[model samples]
Target: MNKITTNAFHPMQLKISQADIGYKEILISGADAQLQSGEVCLLIGNNGVGKTTLIRSVLHQIAILRGTITLGDKNIQELSVKEIAEYIAVVLSKSAIPQNYTVNDLVSLGKYIHYPFYFELSKEDQKEVRETIENLGLQQYDATPLKNLSDGNLQKAFIGRALTQNSPVIILDEPTTHLDEKNKIIILKTLRKLAREHHKLILFSSHDWRLAKEFADKIWYIKDRTLHAGMVEDVLIRHHELTDPSLFNVNEYFKAPHIIAPPLYKEMLYSLLQKNSTADLSHLSFEFMDNRWHIDAKGNGYQCGSFEEILVLVKTLH
Candidate 1:
């Protein structure tokens, strides 16, 4: 069993060493990693690379098969569930929380870790909960039931709960899973703010590499039965494909119709990490407006129902 030292003082680092990522059979082992205060870490890997296992181990929901996991100076296995709750808060996909709980009520559960059973909220705690809800843009839904909010809004409420917990470390599994581009930015920006302003260590797993590259202090890449960690630049250097992006063609810079283009669509098109379409260089201009695909080819306009359509149309002009 893991033990929590009574030291209880905050350390500058959360460290893991020689930890086994899975049970029954070890999925990955001898994994060593650390995250510091004021840092947002992105954990990324293939579907079965044990990223979730690593996170669950760190959160103490599951024991590591071997080695040590520590938050600050104390080993994580030693910490009791309550003590661990104070150190880390988590947001997971597919939660089964009660439908009747209001958004505020859901967020307030984060404070439960700090209080005794049947605990009443202090004025300070109330203020913190309210502030976190507002910060997540959940004020309009504060009094609304969780069942009533859209999936996006509900996701924000869960995140706000994690924020309200006031833990030094926060872990999230696919925090942006169902979000649109705007809400994805909102969630990640909030994480960076928490890391920089509040000095919280944010560990999150995401498939959104572009946003992670923009905001994460470190990228933790788990792959091929190994764990790799470094600042975004260094790690990205190792993974060259992420930087060598081609969202569209390389031959020309066709003007995107401005009305439906996402913010900085041109930059995004040029900086895309991959391309699924090959556009003809002549008589065809791609328009990325309104988060959808459209094309003006030889002065003929067409709106694509999907990206595949755009790809098909682009090839038509080829």
Candidate 2:
């Protein structure tokens, strides 16, 4: 086993080339990407599309069938588990929570890599743990039991533990699992801050691409047994389904109504109007004014109090 320095604070890059990742059979092939420190990358794919397999391969928990994964100057396979731990800190979504452990206790475990659990933490390590908790906005809940905390706070506590690890690279598998929109925003914002301000390389897997892409610098998209790595916008624009799955189901026969409303209401009206077909496909305009929908069908105007009423009117028009 080779020993590597644990505290070198230089810019690090993770590179993958022509890799095949999976267990018995290859799940994802031709995987290639380069991710640098100070960047937040999002790993996106449908369920069971080897997102986790690729992450595990990078962590060297599973061996790549072919090609190479290099972190900085060293190949991942050549690094020992402990050495890899020094480089990467991970938070798995389904990792078991210690039943009776306090938030402070769980977060302090991150320092065990540097200081053994049996020994008292040096003052510097203690301060680091405290700062990590405070940075996570978990200072008030530091002494609270893990079971007592909400899922959002518990997820942040787990992230606090990762922050305390002080590794250059941080990987999270579904960090926003089961979190509401507010918590999801909070978690992603925290990751963006860590990557931009702290210069930590962050790779996180998520199904929430609509929201997650806004915070990501790069995207590692697993599709059709290939890994596509590029700027988030570039990748999303190249793959239309990532932006809107409904594009696949566009009805050639359906005539869309001219909807004038807020973007949100306009999109909703377009979606709802798609399901109904009018016999007279003449000019139809639906305008939202004063919180009500004003409809004009071939110069005949009707006011709709609600979406249901609008649909009922559509039926009458048909």
Candidate 3:
């Protein structure tokens, strides 16, 4: 595990009190949160909702229009750039990727803050860099130039650099943006592990709330110009929009038939039947047995090999 020693007297929480954040006009206001260390927090909001702006304010890149954000008891404005770097390691989504830097070269940059720019990395720092690379499953690309790596691999490399920095707090802006489903899972799971095992306070913003929620210990949801922070389930339940995306305005135009199968298959079959007819389907029944769909329509019997087959048969009924 990566550990960074800090003054024991300092509190281990990131506290925001009535903070109003924006570059010029306040985009998000009345935000208050007391996020503790040793947990993963996921920041979520719609576009133009100040997710990035709030993150920038927390990093002290942009001044807060009102209220205060503190790391322990010290105001963020009081911390120097180097002091902030020591306390927080950040990975931005739009960070410029260097052209000729290899995986090892990029990841090693994390230790530069602790040493002179011209000085070479110490043996211990080099070992940490190598271990970070291996932990991120980037050993295969350790020597490969970053330009030659895929977008997903490049994103992982950036995360590796942050991990090597080993700050008490790690903040990432959409860390899993360029990753595929598998890679997305890998990165989120790794962050969760780091928070639980290494006790790092991890905060990351992502639009993939459905998948990200599983790995998050808490959620920082910005809505109605306020920041709502709480346990994942609590926040999600408080904001019904998160649980119900409202992607489709599904109407119960057709009554559903008795569906019997595993939950997954049964729901899918019912949805298919409902979508195809506006008339009552309560008289119809479907049961899955022996790996086949046994459907009854009034006094008639039909069978389907698959959902597609069931759909075709359903359309004929309609």
TM-score of 3: 0.80
Compose the digit string of candidate 2's lDDT tens values, residues 1-318: 564433446478889999989999999987889998899999999889999999999999999999999987789989988889988999998778998999999999888876656999889989989988887778999899999999889998898888888888999999888788776887788889889888889999998677545899999988889898999999988987676534434566776667778856876776676766534343788899999999998889999988889888888787
- Residues 177-256 of candidate 1: C-alpha lDDT, one tens digit per residue: 98888988889999999989888889999866676668898988887788888898898888855544333335354432
Deviation (Å) of 194 in candidate 1: 1.3
- In model 1, the worst 10-residue window by lDDT is 271-280
- TM-score of decoy 1: 0.75
Expressed as tens digits, the lDDT of each residue in 73-133 for candidate 3 is 6788888888889889999998899879999999998888777889989899999999889
Candidate 3: segments with Cα more than 4 A from true spot:
1-11, 245-318
The 0-to-1 C-alpha lDDT of every candidate, in the order given, reads 0.78, 0.85, 0.84
Candidates 1 and 2 compared: the better one by lDDT is 2
Count steric clashes of candidate 1: 10
Candidates by TM-score, descending order = 2, 3, 1
Better of 1 and 2 by TM-score: 2
